[model samples]
Target: MVRRWQPPWRRWSVRNRLMAMTAIPLAYLFFTFLWYAYHSRLSEVREELAERGPLVAKVLADSSEFSVIARRHDDLKPTINGLLRTDPSIHRIDVLDAQRRELVAAAARAPGGTAELRYYEAPILKRLMWVAMLGPDGKPYQKDRPAASGVTVETIGYVRVTMSPSALLLKQTRRFYVELLVGSLGLLACVLLAWQLAKGLDASLQASMQALREADAEKRRLIGKVNTAVEDERKSIALEIHDELNATLIAVRLEGQRIADLSPEGEVRDKAQSIIKLALGLYNSGRSLVRRLRPEVLDMLGLEGAVEELVRHYDSARSGCRFDLQARGDFSRLEGDIAISAYRIVQEALSNIVKHARATQASLSLALEQGELRIRIADNGRGFDAALASAGIGLVGMRERVYALNGSIALETSPEAGTLISIAMPIR
Candidate 1:
């Protein structure tokens, strides 16, 4: 079972969704605040207008020749004109008579009212904001922006001052817009900063995960190389012991047998037979050691045959122990690496059973279900602590090997219960 590595991008992502999530509310709230502030400033401007309106009216009325009708009317125009010039913000200085006839419309010097002017007037006083109608006072009137108190009495006429915003209002509006622009920019900057921060954090985590994966791969490569080298060394030593040493022992045994055949049935003959028996035992032990160093059956006969031969050897070597071995499902049909990995796990488990488990019987079973291959080795021995075994390096090595092949191993054992080792590897 070979597990392919997952790419970093596929594993997790933080950037895409966060930008939209953080940006929306910030923009909405900022615009809402600006809109409220804009209206508030306009209302304040109207209040300022209301405060200045009556003063202009009072000044004009006081200077007029009230006794003469034509002169008073004539006299009023100059006063209105002077006021208009004093504050260039004054758009139109219309002195309307009580009958609402236009006694004076200063802006008559320019073209008359357009539709835009009517729209401007529409929201003026009726919305409780008549004072705001003054166009910009241009410059001078800022110190004394007219506020309509509705304060004129004798009421021969009413003055309507439309301001082109006073310099102060103009400056304030500019400042407000500047502040609004700055605030919006600040908010956008904050969102970008947050996104960058999140992206950095995600990248750091991804880098750490990549480092871990690389380290794991490197460790596996080193372990595999080292294990292969050890096996090669073992094979070399086994060949030396078998081909050179074992042949000498066999020659000595044959010499003893020849001597026994020649001698009579006496003490010398019995000693020769004993020497032959001891030499044969030594040869068998040497053969077993050679097999342990590198099982030739594993390379030549495939995994299942090697396992069956190993079980038979174990059964012969340890006569008291009963072995129950079975190959279930398509055990013969597996990749060499997977089969070898499974074989090693079984070998290690059986070795552990023989060494640690003082058991009467042991069983080994393997099966393939779906795409996964499962191997189980159980013993009815006096079990040790599974926790300790799991924590130990030997068991950890076994598990690491399994993991390297993209498989899993589980050992179930306690002081009371017998040991059970199960491994599963995906073959497809």
Candidate 2:
């Protein structure tokens, strides 16, 4: 699965991916932190009010007794109003009698729609005959007496207080808004940072890839130039050996024959004839050697005829082997190097067939299509595995030469089957 996806991603340059990889996590981490912090802090603010609501209600209950028993509705305001002024969290307060009815309720400020309310109740218990007493400092104190000692006790009322949580949460909302702002800005910065980092990384890698491609092209060209030079030198050496050395040996043989005809029919004439024969042998051997190095017919008969001559020579030397050549288009008009490379490829392929194919017949085809020179050589022989046979120096050389010409070569073969070598070279 990974291999299947690799090629498509390669189409998007390296930089874009790197930036996305870098920025996404940072923005995600920041936003997650912001989300967690906002809810957690907001919960804390709400909890503070939830815990404090009951405390504020209980405090109001403890002090509401005098206002409730006196039935002074106007007097209940002062007690609640003082506490409201001290703590802003309690937005409203109410003192009710024991009947669960409204008595005196006071609000320092109206609770908004979103504000929460809390209720607390405290009971007022009746006392004995001496209900209250005064201390030495003239402060009122509660005194309790038994009801059984001719004392009557009566129930008074209850105090109910109401509280609001809006005032306590107002300040926390401001801090939460600030956190949201910072988190948004931080997320933007992370995206920008990742984009820049990806661009830088991609640019460097692309530059390196281009440099490597150019270097590889240069190496191929250099190798091609060297191969051309070597071939030229071989041609020059072959022509010199075939022309100069062959001529000298032939001239010497003619001179020896002439000397033998003028001599008497004795040991001297026989020795002269032997000399002529040896010189003639040397001349023939040197000519053969030159032809093997560089086929002279290539310059005379052109590419096609030269190839046929090679095939004919091979057929003569090896019995039970016939080479059939089929051609389309004019090979003689092809570029010199292209033609030579094609001939050499065919030569090498035929050599492999003779040395290894173990077949009686081989077929070679040359065709021109869409400005490309196509050559196919096949042999009906006991062929070896193409994979294993490719390790041979002959095939390697053929492949290298074709590569230098910017051409392509392919081989098809299996054990006990025939072999086929297909090549294509642009004919320009």
Question: Residue 205, candidate 2: how far off, in angstroms?
Answer: 5.4
TM-score per candidate, chains pooled: 0.47, 0.53
Worst 10 residues of 1 by lDDT: 118-127
Over the stretch 59-140, how does candidate 2's per-residue lDDT look in tens digits?
6665665666666778768777887788777766666666767777777665644446665556655555643355556666
C-alpha lDDT of residue 225 in model 2? 85
How far residue 234's Cα lies from its native spot in candidate 1, in Å, is 3.1
